[model samples]
Target chain A: MARRSILGLFSDPDTTANAMDALRGAGYKDWELDILSGAPYPEGTFGEHMPSHHLFKFPLIGAACGLAVAILLTAGTQLAYPVVTGGKPILAIPAMAIICYEGTMLGAILFTVFGIIFESRLPRPRVGIYDKRITEGYIGIVVTSDETRVVQAEKTLKMAGAIEIKSGA
Target chain B: MHNGHNGEALAASPEEVTQDILRKHREFTPRFKALVAVLAVLFLLGVVGFIIRLQDGFEHRVKWGYYAAVVVYLLTTAQAAPMVAIAPRLAKANWRRPVSRAAEMFGVVGLFNLLLFIPLLFLLPSTEGRRTIWFDGPSMSPHIWDTLAMVFLVLCGLAMLWAGSLPDMAAARDHSSGRRQGLFAKLAMGWRGTDLQWFLIRHRIGALASLYFMFLVFTHFLIASDFVLGLVPGWKDSIFPAFQALSALQSSIATMLVTMFVLRKWCGYERYIGLEQFWALSKLLLATSLLWFYFWWSGFIIFWYGRQPVEQNVISLIISGPYLPIFFTTFILNFIIPLVLLIWNAVRRSILGPTVVGCSILVGTFFDRIRLYVSAFSIEDVTAHALTVVPPAHTPDIADILIIIGALSGAGLSYALATKVFPVVNIWEIKEYMLLRVQAAFHRMEVTILAKPE
Candidate 1:
């Protein structure tokens, strides 16, 4: 059995959202539908569970790794080649703390960027079923389902005031 | 003027504001050129002055406090510019769209500061030999670590500025012609405003803003430690670093106010930059000013009550000694003037009133830096038992004055040049915010209701 993808373009977010709900009610799973728009609408506009993002613990992990490296670099280097300054101990806690802080932030920033790229799934092999008009203030509802449900999906989108519908593969 | 009681009357469409900003961006003006020329001359003068200082040996210029003070002051002012972009976003204030691009342009000033640091580090006394908080390793010195941190921060500032400017570059690319179109297209990196692109842009901006905020506190702490606390003998106040950071925020807000006034008057941005923005910023400035006083008082009270001879001597040197005039002036300008004027609702609501307060804070910050760094620089380690503060043996030589003048001009020049290259307003942000903010009747009055995504 082959799957067919349908894209419904609507002028308003409300219409697109309604179409998304009707398609889901017709036995389409949450993962089979996506709402795409030029502007970032509030999440869960289509009543789907919010997409999980890896950004949650990415920066924290980065910070931990950074802290370890910073300790090794600051404390380890000072201990390896000791040159005490101003009667202070060779390994000054305060001086090392500054290095540690900077390293942690640097790591967090690096990881946050990496997490964004990973979550966005950018630079894909190809953009699928995307309309140029979506960037010009159109709301696009993408639905992939069994070929038998194609007509039903089109009817649902039209009922919700979709301006245009395109189906492929 | 649109009066209250009707929600429909006050709502502005996103299309209208975008067109207005784009029209302003396309227009070429000669006024910016004249300002740039003036700043360039001042910058050149500062460079010549620096060269002269370099020619004079360290023995003649050992009172390097004055040099370091000028460098740090300029860097602090430059650093504050980014907060004008970051703070409003973190706070989620909608009025930030108009002037944020202009403020972000100042990130380029970090390059100048980085270059200026070369002299500061070269002339700085060695860490192992001096009684400071810096540590030494086989191949690495404290100054090396300091430079590395500074380089990292400057790069971060530049990256944030560039990332924020990309969407505007795309706008410019689509709505322009000839050489400018190609330039903008190249800068845009083929942004088509897809859902994923917008998501990534928004996410990156938030992450960068948060990092920058934390970095501000961290960088200021390092600065306060290296240049002020580390140099000053018997002057150990744990609150000084936080206090310095608070002062930077206060001065930065003031700088933004002044910049906003200039933009509104000269760039025909009066419609975009409204009194509401100034009113909000004035409140922030006032709050920071009060906190500035508290931090100063926190340190002052402890030192005053301790009655320790060393602490008392350092306090007297900073207050009633040669630095007295500067110290008192900073207190008045940084705290008293801003506090009194900004406290009045009438003054805080007006644009000119806040701009005046900003000017006072800027002047005060300059003097405050001098009082702290110069006083520390003048003292000598004559014996193992103690070091006493004295008047700086060396005054501002011709080079020092020129360097200070140059730094200011350089910052202004860089900002002006940046405006010509990029839209001085964040066009996309304004459009996006316009979508969220709708006028609605609240009880009897019509007010703008900014819907929260949460």
Candidate 2:
């Protein structure tokens, strides 16, 4: 059966780093250490990979929509309400330029907002879990190490000044 | 408070800092209070003027006065890149923090001006209602399209404003007092600031910014064409829209700087809008002033070379005409004052110098607009009717002066009101600063440790 271990979260970065060290030194190199966080920061700062956000698609998708909208609005307006002036064609390129420009920008802006929100995974469960200090610039590192290293890992973390290193399942 | 985040405690217990910030917020300064009082006076004056204009009925003077306000309104659409130009590169600020607020607030305030212009919309007298500022009296054929387009522009712009304001709105909602339930709450759409809400909120902001960029271009061109479409001699420069757009951007930057200066000086925001910001903004003012001069030179040079009678007459009259003093003053104020002051590192670093220079540039840009539009109108009306009237000989009629003051007051009131809540600088950016900088320092230490040889 997997043992459940509870780690007392520190609201401080040094303490947290120290705790991580303690866990590593206590033979819990592969032990599970979890950091309930407030802000989304990269684990890489403490020697781990930070997750990438889906916000990457925003600029590209938005730009495409903007362009398409610009063209459609410029053309659509000309066709919908053709006003020939001084024998000039109803769809004068110069006059319709304004609509195209505005429409494209509007599209991009609309999409940009959607993209950021989508990437954030907003409007869902926001349980008040661990380390509120994370919102205030604290870095929390939670790792599930292999069971063999738990004791040594806890000792190392303790030496490093970890406030708490609880053992668990 | 000056060293707001001097602790290396990694993550501070939130109670202390939050209490400290809240305490600081309560300690409102006299200078800002004084500014707010001044805004109130100006707003009252503007309201009186508006009432008087409505009662007196729209004549050439009153009508053009409204146009001047509209021109200022148009300018807000392209708030210059003062913060963005430097904040990220210089401060190494975080992506999800301080910058968004300024852009968001500016958008929201500009929307207020947009609503204020609704009176102008009603002022349009059907076939007779087509005002000559944004377009040549929304033509019957295009009026339908034009009106719908304008409605869309306004709707999209307003929606963007609300969307962009969401996160801030949530922050404000949670932080706000019982009495402090202001516009944000009314417009917040039940934004609980949840993680789920963040997705829609962030998406809305992104969409707004993209649309804002496009809207600025449209607003720029649309306003210029409206005024110049009458083929008013020197006023008929095709580059007028682009020039107006750039000048609007410059003025907006100057305005933002001035706003920051006041916010820092009065609200005790020592860390938020810092000396570094002053330095960066001063440099921007220097660069933008040069750009302003470049546009002015190109436009004048082309006219001088082409030697068109109408254009030259319009040009020479301003350079050496009875209005020469205002003309030269505009140039000196806009270009020279900022350029010379900004050259020095210290001058840029100093708060007073840049604020003064920025205010000066703002004045100069406005004067330039007046000289270009209002003064030109005086000449055009004279030439068209084959009559002469000396504009400088008479003081500005109460109505003319009031409109300008009223418009400025509108901007001022909005700014003063905004700083009361949102930290002028992004709180998150500062947090980023505290974190990344610490990491970078430790990273360097690691390099040293790795590099050491026994």
Candidate 3:
């Protein structure tokens, strides 16, 4: 009873979404299917849960870390080697505040890219079922199911007018 | 370009749109060549002016802080190009599709801004006993903050542009051949257009756009504080940074409008960059212009009402001094011209009217910068904050004129080159908008509905 990964291609999003809804109605779990398109297709078009993303926290974390680093660079260095000037304190608050702001933004920007890379899980081995036509305005619906549900999925895809289908080991 | 997103595809297919864009990118017309050549000559003259000024030494060069101010203003205003790309996206404005890439490409001009700022570092007055922010420390100076802010802004702008353009790069990679294909493919970052990739790109764009918006305001604040406010004697206006930020917005909007007009007229992109884009942008320009006046009035009224001799001296130096004409011209161009022209619905809805208003604002902003920096730099009070009642104002020399021409050319040339390399229109964004936008009948009237499916 080996599970099969079937990639059904549709010419438009409506057919693809209908196919997905049909598959779900046939008792397939949300995790068993994925959708792919060239442009960013609106989420939930395929009647499945959108994959949750944790990339939002990266900026917040990076901002806090940046603020700390700014403190060390502006305050720590000044305290270690005090150079009095214009009756200003060794640790100038305004200058340090500017430095802190810069550091926070720097960290946020850096970590955001990192978060995207991590969450996308890019550069992974192309293990799942896929299609090249998806890049040329075709919609792809990838469904993985047990042997019994394979026929049901195929029927659902055909009824929904899948232009093509491919099976992956 | 106006396609019903949810129902039938608009007048053209995605493939056809892509072909149209690709054709435009490949063809570099004679008109484009002539424009670039003119800008190039102007830039060279400015460079020669800079060289001569540098050779004349700091004593003489200090007088040319006005030259530095001109360069800084032009370069800083060029940043509005990227803001044009980012702001519309954040607001989900459908009309932004055709022009976002053009706007984003201007971010590269920040490189020239950084290079032009190097000489200004040497020209800055020392901060030994002066009430400046540069604390005495090894390798610590106000220049560091300015440099850091400039570098960060440039990087953020570039990064945001790159992220937004990746899907388009992949599209190009799929359809091109030879070296172009290879380049696009590499830049595409191995995109296969999976749901995961799309999701990540959306979030990444949001993060970068937010960061860029924050940086735009913050960096302008730093530039205003370190360069202009810090130099002027007895000029302790808390609202100065807000004023400068508003001015940047106004100037940037003007620049964006001018660029859009050029693209639509010369590039034969009339159908794409139509009245809708101009109409939306004109309203924004009007709003920013009003805000700009409010901030200026706030600062001016405070100084005017105080009537303290020091504050009065500051006012005369700015408003009624030798730079009197420039001050008045700035008000007329930035505020009066725009206010008069843009208030009419007919003008705001038309291309010619907004373009005229935009040009006026740009000219006004240039003179405004001159008034701010020239008067402040000329005030050479090193101790006890003695305000100069009548600051010496000299007309621009040959070198000053050349430098200004060169800075203007430099910004134009860099943006033209960028357009050549990158797609001037965001094809992917256009496609996405096509998918999401629909025409519907509401209240027995035909209307457009933009669906946000999450």
* Every candidate's chain B TM-score: 0.92, 0.76, 0.94
Q: What is the lDDT of residue A152 in candidate 3?
A: 80
Query: Which is the better candidate, 1 or 3, if ranked by lDDT?
Result: 3
Q: Which tens-of-lDDT digit does each residue in B243-283 have in candidate 1?
A: 88888888888888988889888888777777877888899
What would the DockQ be for model 2? Answer: 0.14
- The numbered model that scores best in lDDT is 3
Query: What tens digits encode model 2's per-residue C-alpha lDDT throughout B17-69?
Result: 33344345445668768888999899778777777667765444425533453
Consecutive 10-residue window with the lowest summed lDDT within model 2 chain B: B445-454
lDDT per residue, candidate 2, A103-151, as tens digits? 5555655566566546545433332223333343344444454454444
Off by over 4 Å in 1: A1-11, A15-38, A46-51, A78-95, A113-169, B1-10, B57-64, B135-140, B306-309, B379-385, B442-444
Winner on DockQ (2 vs 3):
3
lDDT of each: 0.74, 0.53, 0.78
**Cα lDDT of model 3 by residue, B194-269, tens digit:** 7777878888887888898888888888778767777776678889888888888888878888988998888866
Give the clashing pairs for model 3.
B5-B437
TM-score rank, highest first?
A: 3, 1, 2
Model 3 residue B211 lDDT? 90
